[model samples]
Target: MSRGFKKFSKNSYKFFLLIYKTYKLTKKFHEFDRIFKKLYNLLNFVVFSVFLGVGYGKYCIK
Candidate 1:
């Protein structure tokens, strides 16, 4: 009985550890996703402004 109880406890501990690690990984992924989105938006804005400037210059030249 004691051995069985020990085995059960060990399994539960391992299960909980796996869950905790998965949670941490998900949290880190979400943070990285947010940062990537922000950088993507900034890049899009820069590209848009550059294109607008080029278009305006061409229009003026023409």
Candidate 2:
């Protein structure tokens, strides 16, 4: 009946999952230093892209 997708919740869910994975990995293994950095970088990229997309949608599209 309604759209299942909303940008805030969807992106925030991705955020939550990234945080959870980072927590779990840190809790389990010190060897995950490289992997943890990768996830952190990925989270930065995701958030950046979301903001960029929002701006593009608002300003560049009709």
Instruction: Using TM-score, give the best candidate's number.
Output: 1
TM-score each candidate. Answer: 0.52, 0.49
Deviation from native of the Cα of residue 46 in model 2, angstroms: 0.8
Which stretches in model 2 have alpha-carbon errors above 4 Å?
Answer: 1-29
C-alpha lDDT (0 to 100) for residue 3 of candidate 2: 33
**How would you encode candidate 1's per-residue C-alpha lDDT over 1-62 as one tens digit per residue?**
44765577578657755755675577667776666557756855775687678778888987
lDDT of 2 at 34: 60
For model 2 the TM-score comes to 0.49
Report clash pairs, candidate 1. none
lDDT of the candidates, in the order given: 0.66, 0.70
